[model samples]
Target chain A: MKLYEYLAKEEFRKFGIPVPPGRVAASPEDAAAAAREVGRPVAIKSQVLAGGRGKAGGIRFADTPEAAEAEARALLGTELHGHAIDRLLVEEKLRIDRELYLGVTVDGAARTPLVITSVRGGVNIEEVPEKELVKRHVDPTWGLQPYACRQVVRRLGLGGPVGRQVADILGRLYQVFRSRDAELAEINPLVVSGDRVIAADARLNVDDEAAYRHKDLPRVEEGTELERRVREIGLSYVELDGDIAVMANGAGITMATLDIIQAYGGRPANFLDAGGGASVEPMAQAVEVLVSTRPKAILINIFGGITRCDDVANALVQVRQRVGIPMPLVVRLVGTNEAQGVEILRREGITAYRSMDEAAARVVELAKGAA
Target chain B: MAILVDEKTRVVVQGITGHQGAFHARQMLDYGTRVVAGVTPGKGGEEVHGVPVYETVEEAVEKHGANASAIFVPAPFARDAAFEAIDAGLRVVVIITEHIPVHDAMQVMAFGRSRGATIVGPNTFGVISPGKSKLGIMPNPIYRPGPVGIVARSGTLSYEIAANLSGAGLGQSTVVGMGGDRVVGLGFVDVLKQLERDEETRAVVLVGEIGGTAEEEAAEFIKGMTKPVVAYLAGKSAPPGKRMGHAGAIIERGRGTFESKVKALTAGGARVAGFPWEVPDLVREALGQAAG
Candidate 1:
């Protein structure tokens, strides 16, 4: 999960990493107070999960507390990437000597832990000259050796205090990256001031699957009220755009269903995976959640293995009856007495297709009519 | 003779007494898999499904001499359970639970590889060597033993494809659900290579879902195979988004695209099935060409 810069800074401070002094302000008055507390020449950064906040005028500089308050007023409550910026972070702006990049992540292919450090920072790492970026992969079994850090430092052409500080920080950061189960821990613009090096920006992406184990990291953002309610019912539901809602049993098959919809030029409104043993209530709830979209149509794709097709059909019938079906629904039922399930759907005036592509085409037709 | 499993392969259910472990344990036993032991963390000394349930995998291995293990532990403890089985010297570990963290899957996979153990799906239906051993939660009604070897990403899709192939009178020697996770222990290439080297398997069907280079890599491997290979790729219509099932399916800003994978497989010589129903015919044609 992507943590906002301010939140990442909070984590960095906790880890003994030096950061510019900052206070989060939720309002104009709060901004003035934070500015006064930090003394003048501060930066008010819009706090949002999405990137490009700075370019969007979400960040501004203020030499006075009044200017800081005015900057905060401009940033707070402004919409960026679908998130309301209720706050702005006011921090004392530092006189920079140089900015460098350092990060650690798991190598996607080799599946080995890797630590990356680059001399270029304070800008998009992708835009930086690739040859200048110093990268070293550490053997996790052997641990992050000093030589590995020196390799990055030497390539950067820094020596003495700066090199020592970077080498030490790199070692500690790699250790934290493993212990914390972080997918990404990037210190962009690790500012150097004589003998001291401080992190100016912390961009960390923690592994979502490992979220359950970490109590220290930010709690899973219960993004919306509807999502929280759906999670309570033992079915996985995520909201989306489009006019057709899809409810299915497995993730892979659900993905295939979504793909088929796109292939057929149909838009899927959401992904609802009911897992293996889905019954009437979860099914009904899933339908209700999708129906909240009041979608033009619903695509029910259940490829049962352990899950019975007849059981899913039974749930569909109950859900349609209970909810008083409004949208046009197209379903693809296969595996585990799929014939009997199709028979049941046929009896209920629901058209069931054996083919995914055909089913998607039918749903697209239904959706267009509704649209 | 089928690969990995056959009628005589004795099995033990690690994490038996749990919901899926208990359920599939009975199913496998009914399918004629000699389920000799059950391993629960502390529920040893109990009998589940007429099989002796042991506390640890070691005890089960020591007593029952079970060479194969099917894991149904919850996701958080799945890696540990897999490690236990492999450390206890089980030759094969079939993990049924899904959604274990990627790093953990990588670690357990590395550990299993070091111990010379073959690990199947961490999120999968496991392997079924029909009329022999059934070590997973796949509905057993669809399988039969023949010359066709099936390896796939989606478990139910594999079943559907296998059923279609079998109905066409081209039964499978073994069908393996390689797990859909990004960092799964075994890849399509790993399984396809084994099937090619196996004497009994005459032809192979690889059922791949889009989003990883594994399928493309398998296509390259298939180019070297003496036996014919029919490849079927799922999710041809999937829109780019957060993975709905396996974490591996997501397309970042650049790389491992559906279009690229399809092109790669086509460049290799394996006949690619455009959809699920086409698997049987494609396999048939590939086999025919091999014979000619």
Candidate 2:
């Protein structure tokens, strides 16, 4: 789950990592009040969960409280690259002598925590030259040692008081990364103003699987209206900009169905997994959620192992009875109690296919016809 | 012989009293797996599906001679359960629990490697050696005793591909799900090394997705192996940075793209199939090339 910049800065503060004073403003008046409170030139940044915000003009600098309010008013209710700007972080802008990059992320290649440091900082870290970036893998058993922090600092060509200070911050950052179950904790543009260094930007991504451990964290930012609704019904859902909605029982099957649908020239509107051992209520709710998207067609692919196909068919029957089938649905059900499940669907005048390729092709044809 | 488990392999289940643990445990027993003991703290002496229950993995191993353990513990307690199995000197440990914290997963992996144990997954569907032994949650009817060795990062995709192979009169020697999490216990390369050494596995079928460099790493390793390998990669049309159901199934920073994975696997002398139905034909062609 991605935390808003203001929240990430607050979390960094709790770990003794220095961050400039900031406040989240929900309105233009709040932004003005915050700017006046800071009594300095402030940066007003849109609190969206996507990247490239600077390029999209979601970030603006204001020297006065009036200017801050004007910028906030201009950005508020505006869409910056599709994400609506509802919140902004107003913070004191620092006078940077130099900027450095520091990040800790889980490395899939090493299967361990990797700490990355570089002299290249600010926006577009991805565009930074690889030769400038220094990476070190922390031993999973021993964790980040004090010496390792100093080594990274040295490799980044730091020395004297600033080097020691940044090393201390790096150690604390590792602590927050591990203790908070963060998938990524990054501070791009670790600015040096006079003798003090502050994290100019905070980016944190906590693991969704470990979210239960962080009870104090606010509700995670949800994506799309359909995603939020399906989440409430306790099903995994992700909305995509396409023409067909794909549903399956397991994560693996859901993805394969999506691949097949796209391979057959059908664009998937969303990815939905009913999850293991789903009952009639959740199954019916899943269909209802998919139908709410108003896609051209819906593809239901079930290769039931622990999930009985008859139960899924029963849920489809319930949904058909209530909401009525507004869109073309191509269902492919197999495995446990499949014959009975097909019988149930057949009685309702719904023909279920046995081949995934056949079902995906049929859905593509239906989606094309609807288009 | 099978890659990991066979008829002689005795098994123990952790968290046997929980809902998922109990349900899958019964299924494993019905698949002809030698389930010798079950472990659920404070529920010792209770019998689950006619298997003796113990308080700890050590007791289960010492008393019943269980060489392998399948964990069904919840996410919060998954780390301890995995450590217990490793500390008890079990030869193989399969963690079927999903959503284990990354830090805990790293620790479990480090400890297991230090002890020279094979840890299957923290979110996997487990492993199966068709006809002889089944230690995972895969449907038995889909698999048959044959020469194909299957290793996948997906559970249901493996089942679908295996069933398709069986439908085409081909069978499997062993199938392993390496888990779909970012920080998993094993990878395609690890499973591939074992399959290369197994006499029963004449060829390998790798099921991969867009996320992670495991498939790329496996591609590099396949260059040195004598056996032929065929691959099928999912999420070809998935957008970048979107998590496709699985946490590890996202393409980040242009690293784990479908194009890159297919390119790497194809360069490694493996025939990459575009669809699940096409895997059997590729496998058959590769096997024929090996024979000729």
Candidate 3:
């Protein structure tokens, strides 16, 4: 889950990391109030869970309270990079002697937390040259030591009080990263004004799996209504822009089903994983959810491993009877009582295709015909 | 002859009394795997499918001489279960639990590395050498013993590919699910290296999805291997920034895109399949080229 910039800064403050004085505003009036509270010349940043916000006009400079309100009004209800912006982070603009980058993220290859610092900052780290960035892999067991932070700072050609402050911020940043169960904790443009260092921008992405432990973190509402509904029903779902709604048993096969559909000249409206070993009710609910999408057609591809094909077939039959599917339904079911599954579907006057390629082709034709 | 588990390997099922553990234990035993014991922490001195149940991995290892462990413990306690198995000196530990915290997974990976153990997954379908032994939850009927070795990030997709290969008269030597999480134990590179050395495997099929550099890392290794590698990637039509069910299957910062993985694998001399069904034909062509 990606935290809003204001929330990330709040976490930074909790960890003793310096952040510019800021207030979260949900409306234009609140933003104006926040600007006044922060004195004058504040930065109004949209609190949307997306990247490239600055380029997308999600961030704007406000020289007065009225300008802050106007900027907030322009951004508050607008969608930036497909995320709806309802809140703004109004903060006092910092005077930067230099901008530096500090980040802590997992190195997937090394399976360790990597602390990345650069002399060059205020820009995308991906665009930075390798030589300008100093990366240190901190062992999870020992964590980020003071010497390690100082060493990285020195390598970036910094020394004296500013160096020590940067090193101190790095240590605190590590604390926030680890304690918050963050997949990524980044402070771009770690502004150095005189001897003080402050985080000008903060980004924190908490691990979804570790969410149960961190109940204090606010939940960020994301995705479409159907996407949220399917998640509530314990299915992994992502909404896409297409005509055919697709559902499958696992993540891999669902994605493959989408690819196959597109390969056969069909467009998928959504990606839904019915999960492994889904029984009758959840499967029925999954179909109901897909039907709710009001797509031209619905295709459910199941290659059962732990998930029994018969259970999936039963759900299809059950949903067909109860909900009365308004669109063309194509199902390809195989593995683990597959014969029984196909037989069950056959009795319901529904033909279950054993081949994914053939089933995908049929669905594409059906969707195109419907169109 | 297989890369990971075979007929001689002794197995211990952790969380044996649980639903998934008990069900798959029976499945593994029915598949002719040497499932000697089970560990359920408090449910010791019991019998699950005629296999002795122990409180800890140490007892299972000591009493039954079990060298491998299949864990079906819940996510919260998955790390402790893995630590227990690793501490017991079990060289092959397969964690079937999903939703394990990334920190715990990292710790397990580090601990497993330190102990010289091969941890299969924190969330996986497990490993299988068809007709020899089964250590996972994959349906036994779909696979057949043959020359092709499969290493995949996705379980059901591998099954789909393997079933197609089997139908095309190209059976697998072994199929390893490297798990779907961002941080997993055995990666494409690790499993590919093993398959490259295995005598039974003539050609390897890499079933990869978007996200992570696992496929790219495997591509680097594929360049040096004499065995032909056929790669099939999913999530081709998937939008960027959306997690495609699998936690690891996402395109971040334009890295780990389907195009990039295909480019890297193709550059490394592997035949990249456009779809799952096309994999078998590519594998056949790869084998034919190797023979020619």
Candidate 4:
């Protein structure tokens, strides 16, 4: 649910937050044409969903249309840090005296939305000194106050008309962030050129849950190969890499399976939430998808409520009988007709653990012992 | 003896005519929960499974003396329903719906907290005292009341923890699912505080996942507690750079990672059960230490 820089900038404009003239181009020729139209000295940035693109040569500065074309040609098809760059955004580079960082995101600790502003910009916020980051949370109930915005501007040492402009933009961004159900709305390297303030880079990630309400958004990542494979088997599959693959019922247990793998000093290869109502057919497919990794070990953690452990156990048995996956498994079954599941798994020489702590610890030991 | 809800707790169901609401309400009543009223907007004057329905939570609370409400409305209307419950003077509310808009949840949660109401979830299975009362959709068949106070963000994870404890001849005092959404009314620390004060709870079995600072907050709370806690965090290292499942279980660049929560819990002197199966034993060990 991450918007490209161009789309994010469009949102910035909606809030009256200024962004330099820019257009996204699908090709080097298009980028070159855009540079000619925007008139020279453009920044050709790779339109990838990740950051640190500049360090990876996915971003380049070009002073002429020809140079912009050259940079776009070099970057448009090249894979930067594992993501293949298919487009480039040619932006008129803002000449700034100073850069500042401003952003708003949901605070996990306070379970509240926070507005963060700082003089520190043009670098990863994580890299900045924690003490220097002037951060304040906006109680969504209470809209961002001019006083609070001014305090941030004053503390960050931003002065003149630019400071008030930044405050206005921040308020608007927060409004947009809230209205759009965005997980984060960030304007990095917010630049000051004379009296003009422009957003050098815009990043907006819409919350996936909230995306259901945003009907205008194009369905991004349409049934990717991994997603398609899961859908074919009617399984919930999220790809990751490690030797251990997890198959669990419900989001909580799937997460717990992952946590257990980590706690046992193991890395989980995937998180497949078979969900609360999954049956044997879906469970078998889920196991098939999980085993497709050919993991070193597979952990099936089921805290069945609507989903019975027996059905999960039966599904695992069917998977073993039919597909014969590569990994050995550890089973932790609990709740909602668990006895039948235990009976099935035990018949297959699998013993269900009594507790998640025990199951997780054992899998760690088993995976280690196997290693 | 229970932490949140029991037979004495008066309950109302928002969205009572809906499938999830009607279904779980029956189950809660089966578990001995005193569900007195139901709210389904236009469905007032009707009864959902013998529970009288009203048009508003205010009417339901006024009519039934309902002070606690469980919501089954969809994510979009969950915010309004929660506010209505709070407005009706329900002191404790449980929102089982998931994927609520963060802004909506923020307003509802913040407003509810300000009103001195404890909101259990916006994406959780709700809470249960097990054998005494169940406020959520947790299948009533598997649970039995005992001494373990369970608090987890994931529904099935809590049931698994309870099942394991039950298998080891231990029953739960109460198990609370704080919800898996990014923003929830309750937290691990909030549940832990109640568990800490509940005398029937002799020991606590805590289940946590990666992402968010909730586990870290709970770890900090645990450092101040005198009760025995057997803690298990979901999402270990999880491949060096994986997005932890559930919106809240994120690694986020380099903060609130699973490793950090585990480290914080271990540093705070809570028994870190390496996985699900080891939790009962870890609890037994911690309880033994407390007794010693």
- In order of appearance, the predictions have TM-scores of 0.92, 0.98, 0.97, 0.91
Over A168-215, each residue of candidate 2 has an lDDT whose tens digit, in order, gives: 999998988998899999998899889998999899899888899998
What would the per-residue lDDT of candidate 4 be over residues A1-371, giving only the tens digit for each residue?
78888889888887788888879999878888999888858999888787898887788989988888888888876787777789888989778788889999988667788888888888998788978899998888887888888888888887789988988888888887887888899999899888988899999889877777888866555324876687556555677767788878777678766765675688777778887678789788778877776787888777778788788888988998888866678888877788888998888888898566677777777677778
Question: How does residue A86 of candidate 4 score in lDDT?
Answer: 91
lDDT: which is higher, 1 or 3? 3
lDDT per residue for candidate 3 within B1-292, as digits (tens), equals 9988999999999999999999999999999999999999889999999999999999988888999999999998899999999999998999999999998898888889889999998779999999999888888888999999999988899999999999999999999999999889998989988999999999999999999899899999999999999999998999998999998999988888999999999999999988788988999998999999
> Would you list the clashing residue pairs of candidate 2?
none
Better of 2 and 3 by lDDT: 3
Candidate 4 has a DockQ of 0.60
Error of 3 at B288 (Å): 3.4
Better of 1 and 2 by DockQ: 2
What is the descending DockQ order? 3, 2, 4, 1
* Pairwise TM-score winner, candidates 2 and 3: 2
- CA lDDT of each candidate? 0.80, 0.90, 0.92, 0.82
- In model 3, pairs of residues that clash are none
Stretches off by above 4 angstroms in model 4 are A222-224, A227-236, A258-268, A279-285, A291-299, A310-334, A339-371
True-structure Cα RMSD, model 2? 1.4
TM-score of chain B of each: 0.96, 0.99, 0.99, 0.97
TM-score of candidate 4 against the unseen true structure = 0.91
lDDT (tens digit, per residue) of candidate 1 on B149-265:
998888766776777777788877888988877777777877887898888799988877767578778878877888887877766555565554566766654456777777887
Error of 2 at B172 (Å): 0.8
Model 2 chain B TM at: 0.99
